[model samples]
Target: MSRVRLLFLSLVFLVAGSVQADVVNKNVDTAVDISTQLVKIAHKVTVENVGKTPVKSLIFGVPAHIKERLSFISAKVGEHQLRLSETKVDNQEGGFWKLELRSDITAGRTLPLSIDLVLGRGLIPHPSQITQKEKQLVLFEGNAYYFSPYLTEKQTLTVNLGTSSVESFARVQPVSQSDTKITYGPYEKVAPFKEERLNIHYENNSPFLTITKLERVIEVSHWGNIAVEETIDMEHQGATLKGPFSRYEYQRETQSGIASVKSFRTALPASAVDVYYRDDIGNISTSHMRVLSDSVELELRPRFPLFGGWKTHYTLGYNVPSYEYLFNQGDQFVLKMRLMDHVVDDMYVEELTTKIILPEGCHSIELTAPYSVKRLKDTLHQTYLDTKGRPVVSVSKSNLVENHIDDFELRYTFAKVLMFQEPLLVIFAFFALFLLVIIYVRLDFSITDEEENSRVEREQKDK
Candidate 1:
């Protein structure tokens, strides 16, 4: 792998060096935490412009083999998100990303950057096969240092393992090492296109969970509620259970770590209420809910404990006061919410879709996200009393990570005149119904009792 194989397992970041240093990478601190199913790597760095020219962009590289598992590649300058572009990796199977710094970095100015990456293939069973009775020891391999096209004045790498039963480690000269962690030091003036090898085997038997698909729909009702619904397709991608699982044996074997999913929890806004959870089969009863300080927590249990190579599908929904996500900017309506605010930890999402349904008569709908979307569609959706249908905006993407939780802003022109349209239509409908009933009751459609009696008497006299 070239210097920057930090993402997709094959991110060949090849940046040509300049004779004179125009941009200086002062310090880079990379932390790789392997405690969860998905690997979380965070890079905090300080960059400065040393030369007379301004720097426009920087290249980031990632691994190639597991590109499908990688997601939520994002950067931040303080609280603001930095814009980036996707690029094809040269001679590498991974992904290459270029972050554009629109402002010219003047000679002496400095910039602080926070980069976060998620690796879907972080922890896999090393042998790729494990028996029911044996302890799982998985091999984790990666570059010892951050691969960069540019030289760094200082750099560091820290590896955090899941448990202490780690052995058969292959390592280079690291300043410090431990049973559950390793550190490679504060190296000085590093050359580009250099690779450091890391191969270690550790024992971890947690359920390797991945969400194959997630669909979240947000509906805004000016009348009262902000309704949110989510449909999920979840899978346990960990080591397959070899034989028929014995519950009695599982209960008896407490010491051995087994990979299975018993339950999961999620957080909702503080004001959320009327929570509902269900699956394709029916309502899931093995769930609980409660209210915390500023949020509601929902603990959900699947129909059964999920073993490796098994899957479950479910849906959940709740409602909150509209005042929470909607605000008024004079005549315009501004709605703010996350694409996906709550999810399981170490999550690997294969696909994510977010749909926002606005009021019936909203016009000039403007929707924005922090990053680009794989697909976006604007259409009309018919609902109760909506004559013209509500405006629907759907955003979909693939290869999602939990950290993709960014606030999405939607602005639309909502006239006060249209706010009462549905209510008025409903009231008119009821009045029409009552009028029909009154008219039917008063109209003389048949002969009265006296007429019937006179007709009977005439028929008897004629006989």
Candidate 2:
């Protein structure tokens, strides 16, 4: 038997022996935040096991219609986060996920669970196009009841629109509106797989900027520097501008373009230095930077105001001290950095690709991401004084929100002596050049000694 076959059999048995449980949601309270472009949902669930056996894990689900809008989801018990994996439940087709609890719950026992979800592209512009003076209104459609596999004994939902200027909302029974918040049902004994469309149409004049594409490159140097550069392509995904833009009218009215984006703030590390923000034209001097105690805040303003459907592209870069993110103890080095940093508040990123370039002569590379990301094939990148080229690890993800901002760790092995490789190469090149010069001066290149003596005689005569 080959080792490969043996390992395959081991994995098959390991999965077959896993535990399954039957649990019910005793009570659920959900809150939806639609103040900005992104939709944030938080659920506080009280779960109880109804089966005779112990329940080691629980399954959570999202409706198939809106599954593509979900960008991030997490379940926590107390302060500890549980591990969730995508799985398929029998006779069901949706975004089904299973999470293992910290400890198993016996029959008739209860446990409290906290689940949070960040959804992108959830709020869509109602009219899809508007003039400069009109307020931006969006429509949000979601489930009225908690979408769960098991029967929910009691559940309630609250929608916070963060604005009192409302248009219309779904009139589900036992629903009330108070200021910017809408409350729905303390309904009882909800059946499994039940869904009721909840719609809210309201005014949201917030900036609806979205990053269509982002390419982040992090280059590491053993000489105590780590350089990061991000190329961003941004688009205003809100209502499209209907008429021609009028700069003079926009300047006259203070609230001419309420939904138009003029500027946004970006945060960097406290130790970040030599920061630059530029575009294809050249440096943009309209930006401002303020150094805070915990971070460096940069206010980026494009050349023109970003109206609906307008687009802009820029490149932002900075350098941080290697000691802050890179750590090494006797050869093995670990680099901890953010997978995706903050682009703007409540920002939605359509596509994100991150690349990390390690120093030359590094080997035994390992990567640990906070969430699942599609890892691309590793390649080599050659730069100045690079002999064998640096190893570049690339990973990509889509539909990312602000909640996805977290650290990813990379580990690699590099001998301390390899740090001197570039300096040594420089020294050897100079030494070889000097040796060649010495040999060239001493060599008698004349075809004959008579020709050499005649050249010397001509030089003396001229003098």
Choose the strongest candidate by TM-score: 2
lDDT tens digits, residues 1-463, model 1? 3222222121223333422235556798988888777788899988766656777777666655435556667788888878877875445456668787756667777788899888877677765655556566677777676665555667888888767787666656655777777788877665544566678788877668788999999999988799999999999887766767676766678743366778887888889888899998888889989999988988889987777778999999989899878998766998999888676766778889999999888888888786778547688899888888998999998776777777988989989888889889999999999999999999989889999999999999999
Residue-wise C-alpha lDDT for candidate 2, range 296-336, written one tens digit per residue: 99999999999889999999999999999999889999999
Candidate 1 to truth, TM:
0.85
Assess candidate 2 and give its TM-score to the true structure: 0.89
Model 1 residue 380 lDDT score = 89
RMSD of each: 5.1, 8.5
Worst 10 residues of 2 by lDDT: 12-21
